[model samples]
Structures are given as structure tokens and as C-alpha cells.
Target chain A: MKRRTFLITTTAALAAASIPVARYYSNGKKNYPPLIMPEELGNFCEEKVIREIGDQYRKQVPQESEKAKLQQILLTDDAGKLTAVSDNAAIAALLDKKIQDDFNSSRILVLSGWVISVTEARQCALFSLT
Target chain B: MHIDARQLDNQSVIEGDICIIGAGAAGISMALDLENSAHKVILLEGGGMEYDDRVQELYNGKLTGHPYYPMKASRLHYFGGSTGHWGGMCSTFDEIDFEKRDWVENSGWPITLKDISPFYPKAHEILDLGAFEWGAEYWVKQNNALKLLPLDDNIIWSKMWHFSPPTRFGTKYKDAVVNAKNIHLYTYANVVDIVATDNVASIKQVTIKNYAGKEHTVKAKKFVLACCSIQTSRLLLASNKQAPHGLGNDNDLVGRYFMEHAELKTGEMWLNHTEPLSFYLMGDKTKVRAELAISPQKQKELGILNATVSLMPLAMSKNTIPSIKIWSQDDPRKALDTFHKYSNLDKRNYIQKLFSKGFYQSYGLYTRSEQLPNPDSRVVLSEEKDELGVPRANLHWALSPIDKKTVYTINKVLGQQIGAARLGRVKLYDFLLNDDPQLPDYTSGGWHHMGTTRMHEDPKKGVVDANCRIHGIDNLYVAGSSCYTTGGAVNPTLTLVAISLRLSDHLKKTM
Candidate 1:
């Protein structure tokens, strides 16, 4: 994706989510995609996983240490339908598939070039901004 | 005088004031220092001046845990020892590596880095490396063009490594050892068994054998096992006369606590800066290069293992993974040779090429980290015996949970530091981001074998004492990486030679 187009689309999604937008770069910015913090994505993934599993998560995984156990279920497609994906694309798609797989239904859509949960789209419009 | 042990009589009994087994870096350094002394030193080497297949087979054994190099070919069984193929990247172990960190179990050396600091300069000279200096500040003073990364010193600082002409001990010290008046250099004298007294309190004599079928008994006032880590422990465990479990097997700590610098390519860093980070890049003619090491303060605060990260441009790392493929070779030396054959790229120029071609600047982040001491990751006697009639050393290298945690935490720490500084971003490999019991396939051993016969103040916990003397044996001492209480991320050759020099000084005082 082109840098200027990606930034404009991502900025629009962030604006919709009520996140503040700013002049990200001054003078000459490298034409590369802006980097995202891993922990930020990790936190989003963890919360989504907990909410998806609901009461069963607390009953099965007693401690925060056991949260890693959820990774096997979240990262892999149980139905074996996760299309082969590149490393970077896999990040966004896996989370989307995880939410769909847990509910056993397709409840996600692409908005402003971002794949986000349809139910949470208005609240987390920046979900797939990267 | 230099003697070939094959010419000795079948029942010959040779005696010396001090017997140093193995003619590797440790043994040669000790012998060289003791040259012209009043004490008569007998230096025994397993193979001839060159590599020998029959003698190399003595190192053959089974590997059970975590895929490892083939036993026989992992180490060279020759006069100069493993130094024959050493890369000569030398650095001293940090003080933190020796301190008693409560977080690191089986940690703390009985002696501190200060105890061996005095001898490091002499070791550097022995290794034929440059001036007695470490850290980036010292090198920057020498070469004004060098620039350090603007990283904070408190969080991460440069750990300097000085390269050697990589003196091959066997070739470099061959003439000196042969010509030394007080030292007797004997090739093809493989130690078969160690015999101690009835109580096994002291070593009485060691039997040496040759593939030519000649046998000889060497009685000495004191014995130093200067063999590499694996064989040193293997010889100790094979001798079961007085102690059914081996000479120093009373506490079963002889072959335990084995360690290797767990070198892994774990992640990548993307920096926005257009200017080259040339200081981080090692120059062709430069003797010193720096890698990013977490500060000692950070180690205690974070409760993590000591590790250093080196960055490589992504374009230059295309063949890095193929070198690790050498691990599966039946003959590890051949595998090593294959890796060396493919590693002829000029890394610095390659990175420069990427920059000039307008390729995005991304680095392949890699680490050389310390392994927490684990008794289970050890060497034991295999069912098969060598031609010398001693059981081969079977190595089962197991990584502790702490080992995995260390790798993950350090990478995380690096990511945080880079992010906080706004110096681009780090994308950690999925394995590090997740809690997986199994390590990635790209994970490879550093070929640095250490901690088999670790030194300690207490006999129960360690095979050797602070003075490098075996626990119960009054006359037996161990030299080389085998006596290392902890294998620091730094290469072991420099420290191993320093300890050997220290042991030699102690022997001089004792005699």
C-alpha cells in the first residue's frame, strides 16, 4: 500500500473512533508504512480473547500465566479454514478469524480499508488501521 | 623434549612433577607460563599434531536432548584443540555473570571477575589479540571515526569484543612447547583411565594409551585435567575404581551443570533514520566490534539472564539460517566446514549496498545469551566405549524454563528500549511473543561447551573448588571451560585461558 494513502485511510478510521489525529511527520518522512506497537495490538488481542471465551476463560485458565493457552485456539483455525497468509497480514486476519471462529459466525466487515468486528466497529474503528 | 607416546613400552611407567592432560589452549598456556621453571611438566595430547580420525572417535557419543552437534566432530581432538577452528571473538565475562543473582538458580561463582582480572591481559597476549581493553569508549578513543549508537548507557550499552589473529594454539605454540626445558610435549597420549587411592582422596596415576596398542602409566605429584569440557568430565566419570560412580562422583556433580551460549536469531528491528549505524557494524580491519548488552543494573532489576544483541541488515542475513542447518550433520566438523564455506560474504559492504539501492533499512536481530545452570543439561557416560577402553561422553542438553523466559524477556526489553527512544520498532518472532516449550528450529548452539565440572566453594554443589582443585582429590585440579561456574555470554576461550594461568600460578606457589 502507498504510504500517503495508507496514512489518510488510517487517520480517517482513527477519527471515527474519536482518537486524536496529528501531524505525524515533518519535512521529509520515509515512504514506509508507520510502525505499530506490538503491545498495543497484544492488549487488544488479549481483551478480545477474554471477551470471546467469556466465563469459560476464567473457569479454564485460572491465572494470567495460563492466558498463553488461549493462543493455540486463537492463532489456529480449528475448522482448518484459515487461508495461508503472510506474516504481517496474518496478524489482522487471525484476530478477525478468531472473533468469527469463537462466535461460529461471520460478523466482521471491511470499513475504510480496515477489517473490524461489525458489532464493535463503531467503538474500535482503528482495530485494523495498521 | 617432544615424544610420541606410540613408541613407549606397553607397561612403561613415566613420572613427572606435574602432569597436564590435553594440549589445548588451557594446557598450552599453563605449560608455556611454567616453561624454564624448576618443576617438570608433562603435557599430553590425544591426537598427533594434526586431526586424526581414530582419536576423534574417542569423542563420539549419543545426544539425547535438544538437537545438538554430533559428538565426535563438535570438538577437534588435536594438539591445539578446538582453537584450530575458533573465530577469535574474545570478550571478558561481566561481573554480573559471577555474582549471586537470586533470580538465577545455580548461579554465583565462588570467585569473582576480579579474582581473574589480573590474568586476562596475559591471556589476551597469549591469544595474540590487541591491547588490554574492552567497552566502546576505549575503542572509540583509538579510532576516532567509530561512533556508538545514541542508546542510553543505563539501559543498554556496548559490550566490546576484540578479534584475534586467532592464534591456533597447536601451530602457534608447537615450537615453544617442544623447546621448553621443563615441559615434555607428548602427542598421541590419550588418557584412558584415572586411578586414585583406596579412599579416592587423591589421584595416584593416570593410564595413557595409543591406537598403536602401547600403554603407559604416568604418576605425578599433581594432575590437571586441561581437556575440553566434555572429555574432562567423560574421563572423570569413566574412572570407577575407588568410587563406583567415578572419581569425583560422590555428589554426582561431575558431569552436570553443562551450558552453552544459546545463540538465536529472534527478531528484527526497523529504524527510520537514513544515516548508517556504522559503529554497530564491524569493519574488515577493525579489531573491536560492539554488541548491545543490558546493563548489570537492568539484569538485577528485571531478573533476566545476561545477553547481547547484534544487528545485521536483512539483506545480508539471507544465508544466516542455512548455517544452522549444519546442526543435523552426522559429522559436525564437516557441517561446520560447510557453514564456514558459505559465510564468505562481506557483511558491512552488503548492508551499504542495501542503503545505496534505496532498500528499506531493517536489521535481523540476533542474540548470544547465557543459559542458566541446570544439572540435567549434562554429559554422562554412553554405553559405547572408545578405542581407549573408556566410555564415550553422552551429552543430553536440556534447556530450562528459565532459558526460554530469558530469551523472551530480553527481546521484549530491547523492543521497549527502542520504542521508548522512538528509534523505530522491533517485531519479535512469534515464538518469543508466545509461551512455547519448544524452541524455534533456527535456534542453534554457539559451539561453546562449558560448565561440565563447575567450580564452587562447597563440594556438594560443585566438582572443583575455588582454586580449581577437585573436591575430594588433593592433587587433582581442572582447567579450561569445564571449571567455569557459569558460562557468560562472552566467548569462553579468553576466560578459560585466564583461569588456566591462575591455576598455573597457584601450582607454582603450592610446589
Candidate 2:
């Protein structure tokens, strides 16, 4: 997408959201998407992760400080199909696949004209990796 | 699967204008720069695209100096080089980073920061971070709008930052590299030796062998070694065919001056702050998303040197679920629709909020300024050669006692200021003193590695020049954090990318 078009579309779509809309180019008056952040692999990476993770559990709850059970989940998918799994990779794979399929369905309609949904599953397609 | 030179029956010999050893960051960047240029570039990798178990095993060893992601942290054997899994946090070295600090030893770069400044933009554009431009002074947005707030230090401590698409070189740049016309980046051809002239000054050819027992000899007009620090120095130490000590170790400077970011376990918090920080958004780089330190007042008050902050989020920070906030429907931020996307919003705020209310971490680690350089902390050559005749690197990472003292002092002073401002409470762990049976917090390890083949203007003190060229060798070069004279408190990826682009232009002129 052209830079101008992307900004326009993103702004128009998100203009109705509850959050405050940011201006992309201050003087230029282009609107930016809102920032509604959660936990991201990239975020922990910026802060010394081990320190951050340890800090979240260790400092806040002195009672359970002795035992902090932090779990990391990593999942990989090839062409919308799961491929590999790990303890900590990225959160996209950790979130509900139903949501991913929902987002992707909208994405297909938005960009390439393809219609695929989570319910369009075939018994033969769900085979485990050999 | 190690190959012997005698099996060269079906092997190929190639000649080129540039022969790059250790196909890592600088090597691939050079090849990309010279993709269609006149320079005949040949990149040799000890580890190849087809994963070799042995090489992978060696790379899995503890990342002694720097902290990269755990699962993704593999000293890559693939085409894109170690950049395959790199988290693209790009920044350039400052002039102060080049100057020898009284606090640091075996320190100082041969080149000035100006030499690498020009290349930062191209790297930034390539990385896709237009919103957060590098080197450009911070800007503020007047009509700002976003779900997240600035990293107000009153609410959050270490704030968040950003980079472009955060390039994972291997995956992002792989297509252009594999199809390049002028660049021949052979995957498994690991260079064993830099066949130099009898005088031992000029590198003539490199002998390489792959896991399939195949041998290849490559010669070029210019050569570059851009492997990670330990390997670059190790390759020098192992190429003892001409120089008994190693390739560039006449003064034993090849593997010396290893630097990594050492982290301190700042004491934990019992209560998570109710409010989140906005400093990470305050910078002009991205949206005015958050704010932390680095303002004029704070810089002077804390004698603030260069550093970057990133606020981390906790599980409670993500409790934007409609179910959790069902009781508080009137809450301003209780929109269920926005809850899921909160992770994609300004993460720095989430961290500040999480720490404010219920969640907090025990350790607040500061990847402090480049610890004083010490020659004793060096990368040595291992007697054993891998599947490729390339010798392995044995990392002997030891730090100066003063390094620990600095961390302690930073914690004490910074913590006091934080508490004085009522930002957060501070705890100084007794890990450095006798073992603390109660609190086992400690200062240890570097996730960011740097300064092996350092950049220097003078040949006597450094290996590479301001342009990142080997002083003695005409066409040879080095790049990445390994070329950093000092590892600043911030991440090194941006600096490496910036310098690499600058070096590419330098090579362009010479080519």
C-alpha cells in the first residue's frame, strides 16, 4: 500500500475506536493508530528480559517471591498451519487461533480476495508433523 | 561429517575481488552492498544453511557477553548469517563511545562516530522504522492521540523504545541475497585458514571444506572477517599457518577486549504501581507514546550518560478482558474491544501500570555502560576444528572488580533518586559481598557482545579504521558490535547496521 493510503485507511478505520487518535505527522495532520499495548516479545526484549520477568514476580509479591511460576509458550505455523512449538517464541501463536483466523479472514477480504475460516477444516488437513 | 582436503577431487576453486570469511553480519552486509557492483565477493561460512548439529552445539554455549533471545539465539550457520535471528535494535556509537574513558581499560575505537553517522539512515529505512528515525533529535506531537500514555516516570521506571520492522536479517533479506548476481554466498563452505603470504601480512587465499567432505579454495582481492566477536578473533588465532601466534595477533590484540552488557538485579517491588509510565512514548522517534528520563533536567541532575529504557509488562497489565472488568463497566479504559489489542499498544505503559498495582519484579537490571575493557577477558582459539577446518573459539570472560562497584554505585544513587521522587523503592542485594543466603540477586552476564576487532584511526591501538577497514590489509574490513570500541548502555544492533551501511559506501568508492 502507498504510505498516504495506509495512513488514511488506518485512521478512518480506527477513528471510531474509544482511544485517543494520534496524529502521524504533527504538522502534516495525518492521524496515527492508537496504542493499546499488552505483552509482546519485542517489549521484554528491550528491557533486560530476565531482569524484567524476575522483577515482576520477585518484587511485587514477597510471599510468593520464593516460588514464581512463569510459563512461556512458543508455537509456529506454516501457511496457517502449526509447525513447531517452544517454551517462548512469540505471543501470536500463544493467543487463541480462533481470533487469528477471525483476523485473517478480515485480512483476506481487505487485501487478497481469499475466503478461509477456522470452521472450514478438513479431517485430512489436521495431521501431525512426521 | 568433517571433510579433508585430500577429497578435493570434485571440489571447485573460485577467485574474486573480495573474499569474506565467517558469513555473519558485516560479511553479508558487504555482499549486499556489493551485490551488483564490480567487486567479486565470495562469502564463506563455517556453518552452512543445512544445519550441522556440531556447529549448532557450539553456538548454543552460554551467550557470555550479550543477551539475545534464548530459542532464537543460535550462532547462525545460515545464509543471512547471525542476523538471521537478530532483534533489530539499531543505534550508532557516539563520539564519547570512541574516546578512551578513564573508567574503561583496553578501550577506545580507532574511528570517530562521524565516520559511521551517515550510514544510519539507510539502515533505518531498510529496517522500516520511519516513525522512529535514528539520530534525529526527539520531537513531540501536539495533536497526539493513542490508547497508551507517555512513560511518565512517576508511574513507570525503565521505559520502552523501538526500531524499524526490527529486521531479522536471515528471514527478511534472504531472498535478495540468494538471487544476487555478483555475490556468491555459498552456505556450507566454512573457511579453515586465511592462506596468507610467507611474510604473514597479506592474506592470499582461504582453504574451506564442508560437512560433505568437499573442499574449495577461494581467493579474492580484499577479505573481511565479520563473524561474531569470539569467532572473528578465533579465526585469527586459528589461522596460524603464516603467523605462529595468529593472523592479526602479533600484539595479541585479536581476541582481547571482549565487552558485554552486564545487568544488575535491582531490588523488587511489593506493590505494582496503579499508574503506568509514558516515557517510551515521549520520544519523537515513534508517536509521543511514553516518557522516561533523558530530559534536560534529568540528564544534568543524574549526570545521565547515554542509555535506553524499556518498560516491561506483567500478566495483570493484560487484565483488560471484559470478564475481569465486568464489575467496573464505568471504568474509562474498560472497553473489551481494546483489551485484546492492548499488547499491540504502547507496552511501556502496561509495564508501568502492572508494577504500580499488584505486580512487580525483584530485579531491575541495568545493562550498564561498557564495563572497563580488560585484555584478560579475551576469546582464545580452541585446539579443535569443527566440520570445517575453521578453529573454534574458547571464550574466557572475566570482568574487573570496579565493574561491579559501578553497578552498585549506579543502583545506590539512582535508587535514591527514584525513591526521593517517590517513583519506587530500592533494594541493594548483597550478591557482591559474601553470598546472600536471603537475597540471591547478582550482577552478571552480557546479552550484547562487542569490541573484538575494534575500529581505530591509528594502526597501533586498533584493528580497523574509522571506515571500519583493517589498517594493514587494504581491502579487508570488519563490522557489527565486534567493531564497537565501547558497548554503550543501549543495544548495539542499530549501531552495527549504521556502520555497516557507511562501510558499504566506503567499499563502493574503492570498488
The lDDT values for all models are 0.73, 0.49
Docking class of 1: incorrect
Model 2 CA deviation exceeding 4 Å by range:
A1-130, B1-9, B54-74, B132-160, B268-273, B281-310, B313-368, B419-427, B430-446, B458-460
| Local lDDT at B426 for model 1 | 56
**Candidate 2 chain A: 10-residue stretch with minimal lDDT:** A121-130
Query: DockQ of every model listed?
Result: 0.03, 0.01
lDDT for each residue of candidate 1 in B362-474, tens digit (9 for 90 to 100) = 56677888888989999999888777788888999877776777776666667656544545545566676455765665677877899989988998999999999999899
Candidate number with greatest TM-score:
1
Q: Against the correct fold, how does model 1 do in TM-score?
A: 0.80
Q: How close to the true structure is residue B184 of candidate 1, measured as C-alpha lDDT?
A: 93
